[model samples]
Target: MAFLAWSVCAHPHATGLLPETRLKFRPPPNSLFAVLLRSPWWVSLLIAAVLGLVAAALLPEAFRVVGALSGFPFIVIAAIAAQRQWRLPSAARVQQTQEAVSAMAWPAFQALLTDGLRRSGIEVQPAPAGDAVDFVMERQGLRTLVSARRWKSARLGVEPLRALQAARQADNTTADVPRAVCICLGGFSDTAADYARAHGITLWQASELALAMRGVTLPAPKPAR
Candidate 1:
């Protein structure tokens, strides 16, 4: 049965009759209507309306004839304009978005930490610093400093952690040694994680940072259901 089916399918006559046809449809020369409508949504709509009216006045059947004749030409024009105008702004938008996201590192870090700690029932107040100290947590009317470091790479060495410890030690007394939390975009190195754990500093990475932000606003007490 398999051999019979293969022989029938492989037959030259059967294959010749089932020829593939690629269809190509080209619009008419007078496609101004299509062209006018091919711009940004607002621009194309405005242009199409004006052009449609002008075309109707210049043609015999007013609306119907002019619209039918206008579709192809306008489509071509709009396609060209859309390709040029729409794509031109895309590169700029991408660049602007990149700049915006890059600027967000500090804010994202602050928000992430503030949200995370607050979720953990800790109230945090952000202190002004140059890309450092996202917030200082105030519990029981006493402030405990919490710093966030948003590193680009995951492999942050002990130097940063040591420096942070030193800074915290210098800034506050031994009694007020603020627990330093390093928030890294990428995952931390094994050594970094070990150092953080040994030093008693909370090291949050990736999605954990996002969760902390969401934790800040907890649900109010529900009525007895």
Candidate 2:
């Protein structure tokens, strides 16, 4: 599991707006860990079992014990993957949740996002007037500027994200600059995603919103105006 504890380094100025941020554990694109994380938990477990059995059959008697331990890493990966996958809402639940979120008014949706972030132990504060950012979040001594006003947009382009990146840059003073996060119900365009990735902006779409609102009661949609 030590390999799972990779360090994060901020590479600001990669895109000349902000540093390239590796905010999450993004294993090498073609590595086994990446494959295991993407595949179902059961797949990892099956692979681990097969490895253990194969090692036992081929290894000498004395080395069999050591060989069997070769599958331990995969078992660990399976547990981690299972824990993450378990937290995600089911397909049906995600559809229902997204539908509910889409129907919510801006105020209600903002409140929902606030509640979700608070539940995750992040302190939320309102953004300053006349900014693209909707809220400011602080957790573990790091600040993140969150722009979620476009949550209902049909297709989020790079403009809103670029604004958020600018906001983050404006807020930066010292070495520990704030991170940027964008929330949209409608998915982002390919160029938007690429820009976010390049600038270290976290984009939360339908599936992510569903995951965040898990177990919380959504507010009823407002009556037609």
Candidate 3:
């Protein structure tokens, strides 16, 4: 149970450890994989058990063992789904976290973002001078640049994201293509979101930020000057 909770918390996005260079693959909406992934983890387990029992009872005695083995596939699927669905925060908690983040000053928000990334098992470091992004995050030998300095902006446009995308392309120090992420409190303009999708850049808007900071303690919001 503990490990499953950690798995969900560690990979807040569907891409898991992979960079957001492409859309994450998803099963069809009505498919078994989709149903299992969205349902409670125990539902898959229950199905497995019921299938084994029914198969065993319906089959001849000589083939009873073989019939019970039919549920093995579901058992495997159940374990995978459990790791993703367990210990997810309630909607209310997500809302509360977003509210807290919205009220934070840049310094406080930057600290919160760093702490949250660390908890997700990503090594965070200050971005090099003149980089458009504010931080560089590394995991599994791949680097991802993160820009959050304008997180408090009322509306993010394509210009800032375009700068990050250019920075990502220019960073040739590593073999792997560096990914980029842009964070904002009020969300991005339609054009900005489209630009990000085209360039494979990840955008951390209100909900994404809330999920990432789930269990981390948020700094107190600074008073206005």
Clash count for candidate 3 is 0
lDDT of 1 at 116: 49
lDDT of 2 by residue, 4-69 (tens): 565445432211222233325667868888788778999989988998899899989999888888
Where is model 3 more than 4 Å wrong at Cα? 1-31, 153-155, 219-225
On residues 1-225, what C-alpha lDDT tens digit does candidate 1 reach at each position? 211221111111111111112113333435643334343645654555677777777666746564644544433445445543542224434343333323455656455446545655567665545334555665444454444555455456666666556656665433665556665655577787787678766665443343344323322333556
Error of 1 at 11 (Å): 80
Clashes of each: 15, 5, 0
Q: Which candidate order results from sorting by TM-score in descending order?
A: 2, 3, 1
lDDT of 3 by residue, 46-160 (tens): 8889988998779889988888877766676677676655545567666777778778778888888778777778788888667488988888777888888988788999999
For each candidate, give its TM-score against the true structure.
Answer: 0.39, 0.82, 0.74
The superposed Cα distance between candidate 1 and the true structure at residue 84, in angstroms, equals: 55
Candidate lDDT values, in order: 0.48, 0.75, 0.74
Which candidate gets the maximum lDDT versus the true structure?
2
Cα lDDT, model 1, residue 209: 41
By lDDT, the better pick of 1 and 3 is 3
